[model samples]
Target: PVNRLDFGTSGLILFAKSAEIQAKLSKEIQEHRIERIYYAVVRGVPAAASGVISLPIANIDGNRRINEGGREAETFYRVIKAWQGYSLLEISLKTGRTHQIRIHLSYIGHPILGDLKYGVKSDFINRPALHAGKLDFQKSEFKIPELAAALPEDMAGLLEALQA
Candidate 1:
């Protein structure tokens, strides 16, 4: 999950159907064959329509931190929709690490809408505004199905309010 799904980023997560599939899938992850699409609610609008975030990530003790000495992590983000002081985003991760998206977004001053750890002060929805909207995978002998999870109630409710 992208930096803790908080209490709201509930969506598709791929699980291997068998131990053999799990082993193969694990290997594919290292090769970067697994793809993930995330949607997020954020405060304020981003200046650019879309861009890439390249940052090194390392596990510092128990927390993930951005550092010069860590492994490379990349995130691709684009604004999907916006209203008032908020915007929806489509995020893709090139390299998966703990908290990669959250840390990267926060570093850029965007931070997910209700993320408490990174810094969002909203009491109405006090959790990271992220969801694993889609997943795609490739395998040689077998086909790993593409998956899509529906938006959670809170996020849906928020969107409903915004639309209304």
Candidate 2:
């Protein structure tokens, strides 16, 4: 696979027709030529409408944590909508470290809804209220059009409930 999504996170996974193509696509990802966009419902609203979360993450004892000496990771997020106790966010990744989104959002005190490991469990959804909404390859040499995936039923239902 060209990229991966965390176990409970729903998203797009790129695959190659051959090993050679896989290597090339992997290189593109490593060079930050591909853009990944996500939609997430968080527990609370952020203080800012949009901002970047530049923090390093390290896997300690099988759990990801924010550590000063860890590998550099960056996540960008903008509040798309806010409700009484929840906010919808449009998120992008500058670096894709394991569990980067979950950790960063939790660190900022607005963990994704239903992300039990990073945040409190939710009654709205069974898994993290996150979805890989779009994969943009405009910057890459490959002439493929952008790819997008709609939110799964569970996430869509959660959003509907939140909106009401």
Candidate 3:
């Protein structure tokens, strides 16, 4: 794994089937060839419907921190839908890093619900309301070149609740 995706953040996680594939996967990631999408229910609605977060990430003595001196990262997010007191968000990462989404969201003042380190606890939910919703990639070496997985039942439930 590139880095631990925050505690509740979910979405597509790409894993190589072989060592050789791992090298290719790394290259693809560096080249921005892979497509990843995430969905989450944040505490508050963001000002804009869509935008990007360009920041650097680093760990402060093993504690994840968004330090300016660290590697650059990019996070793009769009407001999927807004609810009574929250907004559903779709996020994509341009550069994978430890806790990239969580840290970036917090940096912009809209931390994911139930995200403790980067956000305040939520009374509505006990766990971080984030999910790795989908992933798309070309598998040139395999017979089936493309594949996708739907969100889990619990995650689907969260979406249902958000829409309700």
| Whole-model lDDT per candidate | 0.76, 0.92, 0.74
Sort every candidate by TM-score, greatest first. 2, 1, 3
Q: Estimate the lDDT of model 3.
A: 0.74
Worst 10 residues of 1 by lDDT: 1-10
Q: TM-scores for all candidates?
A: 0.84, 0.97, 0.81
What is the per-residue lDDT of model 3 for residues 7-96, given as tens digits with 9 covering 90 to 100?
656555666677787787667656766656777777788889999999999888897777888989999999988877677888888987
- Span of ten consecutive residues with least summed lDDT in model 2: 115-124
Q: How far is candidate 1 from the true structure (C-alpha RMSD, Å)?
A: 3.0
For 1-164, candidate 2 gives per-residue lDDT tens digits of: 98899989998999999999999998888887888999999998999999999999998898789999899999999999998989999999989999899999999999998988997688889999889899899999899999999989998899898888
Best by TM-score: 2
For residues 101-162, what per-residue lDDT tens digits would candidate 1 score against the true structure?
A: 88898888788867877747564465677888876765434475777788888787767765
* Model 2 whole-model lDDT (C-alpha atoms): 0.92
Rank order (by lDDT, best first):
2, 1, 3
